[model samples]
Target: MTAADGVAATVDLNGNFPASPPGSRSKKMVRDGPQPPADPTAVGVKKSGVLWADLDPCDEGRAPTVNGGHADTASGANGANGANGANGANGHHAGHDDGAPDGVPAASDRIDGVLEMLETHPESRVLVLYTGGTIGMVRDQSGALAPLRNRLASRLRSSPTFHDQEYAKRRFGDSDTGPLILPVSSEGRRVLYTIREYDPLLDSSCMGIEDWVRIATDIKAHYEQYDGFLVLHGTDTLAYTSSALSFMLENLGKSVIVTGSQIPLWELRSDGRDNLLVSLLLAGCYVIPEVTVMFGARLLRGNRTVKVSADSLRAFDSPNFPPLATIGINIDVDYRLLHRPKATEPFKVHCKMGSNVGVLRIFPNIPTTAIQSFLAPPLKGAVLQTYGAGNIPGNRVDLLEALREAADRGVILVNCTQCTHGRVAEVYAMGKVLWDIGVVAGADMTPEAALSKLSYVLSKDEWDLATKKEMLRCSLRGELTAPARVLADWDDLDAVVRALGAKPSQTASLLVPAVTCAAAARRGAGPLQAVIDAGADPAAATMEGRTPLHVAAYEGNLEAVRLLLRHGAGVHAKDRFGRTPLVDAVQMDRHEVIAALRGSGAHLGAANPALGDKLCSVAAVGDVQRLESYRLAGTDLCQRDTCGRTPLHVAAQMGRSAAALFLVSSGVDVAAKDLSGLTPAELASAAGHHALANALRSRRSNFCT
Candidate 1:
């Protein structure tokens, strides 16, 4: 017998195709309180509305069929593990009686025999995440395709290319609603995939942060249970979703391939058939340990991908980065390009992503107020799409100042280029000005990756501003490639590195600073050294995190700071918080460390927020020795907290007469008033430190005289 006929023999088709797919829901997708009677051909006797076909069991020693026939009560394939019609949104018929025996179930119910996630199997088991898209679409009453539910599953089950009836019958008997196992491939690979369709399928253009989080969270929930995942998504926002997933699922060790088609699967010549077919193989038959986009004939790094055409079959590409794999006559995976996570490291999925970030594309004569308002409050970060090579108009001083103010306010602004296929370089004067004003060069990242990475960085409550800025510029995933031209925008070390990359007349030490700030955020000598030795730009090094120099100074790693400095790390490098190593050193009065950084030509960070936190804390606790140390470090001794309480204000309020004496003797404002309009002496009086209040008032009067 032919394969098609052999496959058709397992189930019964009565030529009674429904106006809609069986188990289809209404436009609202609302569940009915009381369901309708059963359709005779459906595997579930209780399933109502309409039936595409009836699934039957084998002969005497086998399972039963649901076609006005006796039940295979011993096998019980359709008894509990049968088709459900609760979603049969078509209301019940008045007089049409469904043909069923007296003891058979007549009300709609869900199939209760789902495969467990933790179930063991030798074959590759994939969770087919059927989110609403072209691949899972069907024609409604108006002949317009919309996101479908069980129809795609039904199509796969009915197609011999997708399911092996004999194999499934031997394995799961008459329960066709369980895992849909595919026929063995020529390479001896068989895939067992289960469909987990999303309720009220989402459209391609409507996906957002919360939707991306939902997809990632689902993958995490079934992470250990499945070998891989295949996401059927709409084509429009597919790239954004993929890029967002790449950031949301950190340290991922399994494959997450997002795929969709231009034409709906319900169409006669649908591209979704091939897209879904190949995506399934890539997800289940291979091990690519990173989030990826699989479409047309290429598998690309998720963060590096961009949609190339709106209607072409070959729709996506990783313009800057090469495809991880190519599928033509044979699937050719570039094994070297795959991200290999350490086996010992547990995979973590970041569920929380801040949504305060936005994208701003720069154009000629764009209003300064426009950018100011766009980058204003509620926007903590932004992806600035600039002119070629990351340039801003040098003549727009107002624009420059507005951006500078935003950066100063701790808004992370990442600079990405407007071109489709090149890295952002700081070759122009204005580009350098952007770097100087604290705009992070986004290198070659797509706008999707840049914005998502920005949100991810800002959501990290533990990382300081310095760390966030450093991370925004670095490669956390394979999203961007920092070209050598970026060196010119950095310090002396990077300029030298940039020149050396051209094989200049003279050569400096190959040991210029490189590596993500997140990796060696604590030490400059260990992880930073290792990555630098492996040819990382010590100054530009990042692993989707902060710079090593930023971290070394923040953690008071005196020797690490020295190590980085001795190796030509940028002494003037600022963290996302705009604090230079010198500023961090001055914050804690790291005397010898400050001297070392200053000796290396480091300057104080401007408008730095790490200004007076340490001073206030020490003064509040009456740590006289620490206060003395800050005075020697050249601290202004006048920095205020959020409430406008200066160090002297804190000292007076805490009633530390000794601390107050040190501050007043250091030429501090003895009569400094707080936000409450209460002077230092008044604060001391209010707190019942009457003796200290008198002493402070005497000191203030002496100063006035």
Candidate 2:
């Protein structure tokens, strides 16, 4: 596909492209309420659009046509900076400001005040390129007829609406050489034309192989004639034209503004006036050095804009990019986004385009007819929007046949994912289908990127299939994310931990697959380690019901519990759900880990505040050595476990005399009270433990000292 091929298909008609939807409202005025703080670097005022001119002035008034004014004359007496020779200190005569530069007004700037500032000049040639639109239309006895340029100029000069605009004041000056109006007519009502006073329709879109050749020849033909060039175009395929021009216009130093209005100038609330004013400002200025788009108060690189919305006044938005300049309460220019001119003076233009483009979107249950249609097309290039990680459903012969046919026909198919985030790759068995069928992976490019890349690829006449394939595999403009999912074998749990480490929010950011990957990797030392590594505190407990220690104990992972403890996992931590590790273990009946936890000084009863009696019962019924270990490890001997029996009371009640003796020897007073206020000995006596009662008496006598 070559630039020539794309241009060869162009139909001759009104050159302007699609206008914005009707009845579209402008963005609500910023001045309706309290004003925002002013910024000096603002790009455009609301009404004036923008004023971008190079700082230098020409002594001979022979400025560069693209960046400088269209004529040798000055803009106005205080409207525009004058030629260097005219600079004398006569109170803003050319370079000085003794008083208000222009006599229009002294108030602060407004959204609609962009054109009013030009009244300061007397000698200015404001050529009006009147592409037959409502602005140049007047109703005669016959009907609506295109008015003459001079008449249009007079109407503009007298209208208060024009007075409110800054460009009108600067260009007309309320004096001589009011405002020049030149009318241009095209074929249809749908497609209007915008032309300068001279030769028109030399836009990149209008350039064919022959047109490109001629445009290149024309620049050489009129090398020293014009000041600058401004192109008016439709938005639909503007990027393709811009990209073509950027490639063709090599080492170019002048500015070219490509813009068209959403609403026709004939409409009462049209955007044409603003778009026109700004385009001229850009052309007459000396600052802009590359191909640009001036529309709806924003100036963007011609290649960056995409028509994101169909009907809104803001029809175009550069989603994956920043704007070059924005016109609003004030014009704001992002100097960084602008390209500096090349040192070389002259530039050559190459006008060529390659065709053979195709695009495909894969979805669930995609029909055979749809698949066959794309494969059968006259396509040189294609982009396929695929499923997760570039996967396709099971081998439907039709899907395979369509893809195979396209590849067989020498058409390039590039795979891009439908997912907004993450890359496409061979994650599942189905993903290998596109890879096997010679479909190049796009990694993670937006649809706009896919289209732009396809256009660029097809534009180069000499590039081969192999070269095109390689280009798709590579990243352009930082659009794709490649070599995706390095931790394919990771476990979900581990992924959750890593996600916690990097993003501490409770809501999961990485998807289910990522979670599975994290879990498969490693148990990750311990919950504490995972938590701490994920930027969470080792001491943090679950908001719901369990600390990591509680979970570990409940799961019978004694080692995990120990690791948590060693790393400062709070053993005494209670969950918001009010369960502790020991309590959880007991509830789950994980006796071994529970016994181990008890040995390690875990307070099982404390977690529940009601498990005292149960702990005592378990101690008596279980191994005596483990019981003693629990006691030595700081279990409360006098406190009742869940069953409401203190250790001594349990021992006496069960007639475990040796256990009773150990409790007495371990300094558990038999006189300790239960809920009934009955001492252990009294409860024992009531149940007939006379020996335990005598022992309690002896203990009381010994403690009397």
Candidate 3:
């Protein structure tokens, strides 16, 4: 199928393409015409289509007529109406000059017309390698969809959904050479991309180790020219390709996204648009240096993914690991979870891949002969999917003997769990038996990661067996979590302290917040008593001036409060907010803690005469009655703290909805700005309190009226 045929099929599927009005040239003529002029006035105007009036800026009263006719310069005369133009080839209204009077161009004109504006802006260059995928599939003469070679670029250029004429008009001319340029605006920068489609594209199911090597080699060739890359592929084996690429590319310092869709782009309800658009944007804009799979609004580490469903749109998941990023109204990236590449390391590719690895799933009633046949010669490594927690039936001595024989024959066997989650460890007696027989534990690694890593390891001919075993246990490319330290004996608490990087005598000097210690008490009495018995100070205060007693009282931790008081913790201590333990307990409605604090001689109200701190404290704890009392006492309603946060700001930021409602009812300034110039409503929105923010906005509007 030709590219034009693909585009025509898409247009027929949608039935959205409008015909040209009378006297206008055909859509084909627009594409064949000379390139539009560089001037902003002529940039988005389709010369063969509608005739539009270009309003005069100097003489605002007059509007220019169609066909280059002039109107009255001073009478503010209206010109004769021209035929309405059909939608432009780029999916924008052509020659509609409504915005010409205000000096702001129409949406269609702004598509690629922003080139001059982008001259001073930074550009992120992306290279998209379009391999065969559903995104590039087109129907043939018999109406069956298939991969079309040399048609992807043409289809993209002709489709308004992919190519915005205005955006195309803004290309940085005479500066570079490559395929199609796609413009994307994100994060205050312009992303320009070039698409390079592969010849005789192979389906993802047919993709192999050699194909992975080819992809890696291509990236290595163009590494210096582009900032990032996007690979369009079939979804059947997308996860495998991503995994292979992850290991094949070493010390990669740029983002490489593997993405495809289940639906073809020529369909009306296709998911290809969002998937391709987001992949392009992320590739061009972000600095994530790992091979990742972008699908179903998630950015997952490629090696950790598995195809969980064949029919669902959300077909892939990283069961053992959380996604690195999630896409919503905003793109939320967990930077702490992302692996940061060292600046000193240079990018390289390891093209050699071992293909002799296999997977064996253990099941009940399995014959010993079957196991031996599978583990026969030529299998360099195998991933044994053992029962829960890496356990095989110990009573099946014959099966165990076959595995032992395989190991004795120098075959590397990795033990992973059949379950989607949890780690394989020597918790069971059967597990210990496998461990004793030279089976390596694939701790918390998904099957995909285990198999891929095994192949990658066996391919390294220079490395010895011991080195490969050690590397298997260690985390090498963020593929697996390192094995945790097993401190079997806790008889010596001092040793535990030393292991935690603290001296026995200095244990009490631990600077962890007292509130955190109080929260930790909920886990068990053992950890709390260990800290206390190790000479930990019960009166330690965080930088916020909150003591263990204050946090205990607020959290209603009765035993923790008793322990702190018995250990010489002060009763009259005040926080930096001028709040006492009694105040915190009372505001939190912890009746037991309130009684205990009162018995310890704690007092209520602020520790000082600062009205801002007192009001903010009351609002933070939802003490509506106390706030009302302060308002009745003639205290400033809009008082601000040292941080310039008003009581309303405090209530909104802390999600104290009732307190915010009370303050609003008391006629407080809802529009009062904080130190950062955000109003209470904006603070609530930033804090993710949508209901509170909406209420505040509604109240502010009512007050303004």
Candidate 4:
């Protein structure tokens, strides 16, 4: 399998692996906590009442008024970048050190000591889609706050913090239609962006499956036009929209950040300006490569996030997931938390998001009729936000039967916890009862994510009830955490195997998945032998879909491969990427392992065609993590795309200078020409990426014969 397919985080070496981004997650962090993403925002206030309007997460929000003649000099903080603000009507907060070493070179420079990152790429074109939120709100004649439509750009231009008039005039002289240029960040790259406003605008509470589809389609329509996207949404259901988009935008390889504010931009005090500026910077300067939420100083995974506070500025948090990147003196991205997909196809927008879904928050003495009615016809799926650890009132036989009937009728019910942290598992008898009745465990997924995911999963018309139920358990996006069956009870593999005794086959079946995971941690012949002697299955794979044999080849453990081969491990068995153990060895340049695999009857043509296609896409998207994996896997960097253009050609044509530079360093054919008889540099020039074209041409002589 190729790097694009299901791969583990075991081979982390300077961002050369998918399991972790370089320096984002140190091995120490990987072993300690739940690995990463998700984000949050303000809800108007603490929702209190006897009951919700409906059992579903409804879009009924207090309609905001429009600011027809709002002034530009509104209130907000001078942002963390120290670029756009003078001071807010409320106050200002100082920027803190991101803890990155001070002498670290600017993002545009040839970074020393560490491997090249996509951040080194210059000049990002971004699309700032204003879908209406508190960010653009202003006081109306009635002294009420309302989202202004079609006038966000005008408001942004009024403030020097939001728009740098001097930089724009200097950079785009004589061109009145030049893209707005954000003040260069400390990382040293400018975000050239265009603002697209929704006609009437929307409060996120009004967002649904159709709205999610619209946003996803917009991104797809202009997918190649911009480097990334920043979505401004209302806080009430921002997390829900984020979750919906993550699922809808399948196979995504670019950043999509959703952010808004607790207060309006034109208010005497607001956090809107700071939120907007940071979202712009992140959308352009860095390659986060997942749907994220940026608020306060945290960059989170969109789906995993929940709106924690009603009026507080730091409104969102992902209790089950950690922040992907923290905004401070510098953005500290936990590279390992970034979502790298196994899908090799082009980025697609799943527009068919099913809307016949709702949420049912279970409580004490809830009626059976209500449960039956909620799961009635026309309602295909639902999120059951049950008691802690996914328990329901076990004594209520009527409630149990109602759920069973729903399951029999093909209605999908996912059991998510009402508690803030932890996932739903069948540890308790009550929980097990739900599982027996076909309630899918919603492991650590927020209520918003659970509902949104239910909509997406049920919309898959081709998938049957069984497949949909299984998929609900699987992590399609970073919406839910992967359930890892780890053996945390034992400190080491050998000790555990020893404790199980010499003939442990009967118990080994239960320990097989854990054994495969232990194999990745201890990549040696001694440990493999100890575990094998204890009768752990050799074909078993970890939660990441990597077999023990794959780990041996990845780690270049020749002896480990030999021992596994002797035990009849599949040398040609494919992983998620259609990759064999031999291909893993081939990519790692482990000649000794290569020889051993061939000796064990591995085919010469084991390299994946899917790998090449994914590699080309990664380069175009400037995904340094996946690209680094391709390089380490010894993937042919000279491979061509559908247009007969190499990855270098694609990167250059797409203005992905950083990706192109990475291709050059990885020994791609820089002098090669495409179908148009255009060199990589020529393609860059043809596509108007002048600086990138010039850079490629300058480096071409180094590879000349």
* Top TM-score model: 4
Error of 4 at 173 (Å): 2.0
C-alpha lDDT values of all predictions = 0.62, 0.46, 0.62, 0.64
Q: Across residues 411-430, which tens digit of lDDT does each residue of candidate 4 receive? A: 89999999999989889999
Better of 2 and 3 by lDDT: 3
TM-score of each: 0.54, 0.40, 0.53, 0.55
Candidate that scores best on lDDT: 4
Q: In model 2, what lDDT does residue 466 have?
A: 84
Can you tell me which runs of candidate 4 are displaced by over 4 Å?
1-121, 483-705
**TM-score for candidate 3:** 0.53
- Is candidate 2 or 4 superior in lDDT? 4
lDDT of 3 by residue, 567-627 (tens): 5455545454334455555444566655565454343421121234345655656667656
Deviation in Å, model 2, residue 201 alpha carbon? 8.9
Q: Give the TM-score of candidate 1.
A: 0.54
Residue-level lDDT tens digits of model 1 in 31-104? 11112112111111101111111100000111122222422111111112221111112212122222334754
Measured by C-alpha RMSD in angstroms, how accurate is candidate 3?
25.0
lDDT of 4 at 471: 93
TM-score of 4: 0.55
